[model samples]
Target: MTMRAALCIWILAAVICVGRGHAIVKHQAEQDTVVDSRANTASLVNAANKEFVFRLYRKLAAHADSQGKNIFYSPFSVSTALAALSVGARGETHQQLFSGLGYNNTLLTQENVNQAFQMLLDRANETTRGFINSGTAVFVDNKFKPQPEFLETLRQSYLADGFNVDFTKTTDSENTINEYVKEKTNGKIDKLVSNLDPSTVMYLISYIYFKGQWASPFDPVLTKEDMFNVDENTKIPVQMMNMEEELHSYYDQGINTTVLQLPFNNSYSMLLLLPDDMAVLENDISRGHVTKWLKWMRPRRYDVYVPKFSIKTSYSLNDVLTGMGMTDMFGDRADLSGIAEGQKLAVSEVVHQATLDVDEAGATAAAATGVGIMLMSYRHIPVLKFNRPFMVIITERNTENILFMGKILNPKME
Candidate 1:
């Protein structure tokens, strides 16, 4: 049996800031000087983001709802949205956001984080090796006015655009926000907002759309139907894409996992990990393990089989973020004074949606986060068949930033 395969994923997150008030500023500098001064900051931010990625992933995996199910998300997208929100955060709210994002332990200050995000946003949106479109937008209620410093900060540091909407007209407001996200994600995310809160003074959204062709495209003719073991007793048919080539691979004896590195035409690559015991791998996996795996990988020729599959996941991250020490942002005690001076503002909702599709041509992904905020791989040669559950991590080669990460328990389950 043969199956058609195409890799395309979408992620969206939205944050709803509820309050009433108004505030406005502007500055510009020589582009050359700005870039030179922030040259080292991007890597620092990227490191912090990576640490948060695994921590968040472990949290997601531990959720009861995620048991025996496929997981997919864009950590970079979520971080970007929260980082943008942090601009308007004050006191404990800011500290919670900082610590929750794993930036507190680092040497980075808030300004450093902003500069790094600015650099990353610029690089991601550039028409370079692959198609990566990342952007942020704030939808403000016409009746509400944010602080001048807040808006200016978002615009300068996060590359965010501002729009005015009448929140009283919920449907219209939702459509406006959704349409912008849909267009940015190439229609990969069409319905990003629904049932807008009338009290909401602002809505912040962050989205990332990525489409990349594989460096070594798989021949469609070589794809054949095969069986995937979902568990001990369950098996499902899948379109297993096959290829035999010299590829970077590693076998970690400590955790009994096989790692494979699949490059994209751009400066990105997918790392796949198939483990003998998923529990052991999950418990032991960390940044150190990933660094070691990359360092230990060697080029080798092997027969590889990857299931062509697509999966979509939606998460309500309020509980997860709260569990991760981001409690103040969602409660009555929340202090977002920097956003608006006279009004009490708190985050009412956070939603994240992501989708992934993998095929012979390559992989394409889109993610959106709304505050209503919300917030790989591989292959084998040596008869490395992904016949069972495995992990997928897509990372940028130069920055070492993890663009997306998840686990595939069953390709047939979207």
Candidate 2:
């Protein structure tokens, strides 16, 4: 069963905020060094988040709306938003969130989860090589006040900001929240909310933005028009970027997949998987496969052809979250009383948006000498062309956290 190649790319930056009882936060800090049990717990949480990432990916991929379309999102952004909501959730609502997030099996307590998130947030905000800004905030209705303890948890554990907006002023409220998101994401997402529901007491939102250049930049002179096979019966024109370099790659004979690692100037890397059967690979892929594939990859010189493209995606994940056993939080039975007393509150919506761009440039200009050397040795190398649909995953090398994950079914589709 030979399936077409699929491209999966991961990018960075995330923001989470809420209104009414929901909040969003944006965090940025200098890199710090630390060795403690909290750090260890953070590592464990990161691993569990990986599981959440794949489970969520499969769920989204199976959605009727996602069929034969491009899928891109920041799992970290969604998870962080829900985790922030969990701070004020009580009883069954909290339990469901913990289970849905794949945290019930672990030995982590609520406080532990908070601390672990804080540690991870600090690390994610560190911008040593590339730009990564992650944060959460809560936008509360002016008429309703949230409990002090709940806000404190969000501020301390999630590094979130708190705001009170008058929901009655729908347009003003929407602009306030959307402008904040636009600024944090570097204008990647201009509008995050629209047609505000007057009954909405709180809005929980999460966002991320990432920009990185290839370690071995492609030469634009070598890029040319190429036909990209979207599927068996469809093809589209794309500007395919070309490069020849010694890149780390592996072929899993058992699964009939070829994995390639493309590093950024930062500590992050994009892992591209080309499988013989897209369905089979998607069904069988797990964190274990990712770890094994990375471990087994060895460097080899190849002439690679990749499409230069940009994509943006937006999703309303209420149904998806409900299907994942997080139903109570969106219903009247939701125990969000912890967020505010004497007022009924429930999450009305959960929104997520992300964008990514790839081109022939790095943080610094591509080395002219390096390009010349690669051109000199290009003839004997094997060719690896990404002319078909494939999967892409962006991950932090040190923490092994999957910042973003998606498949490119059609590059021309925005």
Which tens-of-lDDT digit does each residue in 1-414 have in candidate 1?
321111111236221101011111214555876656677666777788889888899899998888888988888888988888888888989999999998853577789888787767666655243366666788888878789988888887777779999888989988898899988777877887765667677888777777766787676778999999999999999999988767899999999999999887767888999999998988888887778877778998768899988788888788888999999888777788888876777887676787777877778533221212001226542588899999998877665678788899989886
Candidate 2 minimal-lDDT segment of 10 residues: 2-11
Off by over 4 Å in 1: 1-37, 126-130, 365-381
3-108 per-residue lDDT for model 2 (tens digits)? 1111111122332111121222433452344345667767777777899988998888888888888888778877887888888888899999989988853577
Error of 1 at 136 (Å): 0.7
TM-score of each: 0.86, 0.88
Count of backbone collisions within predicted model 2: 41
In angstroms, how far off is 167's CA in candidate 2?
1.3
Candidate that would win on TM-score: 2
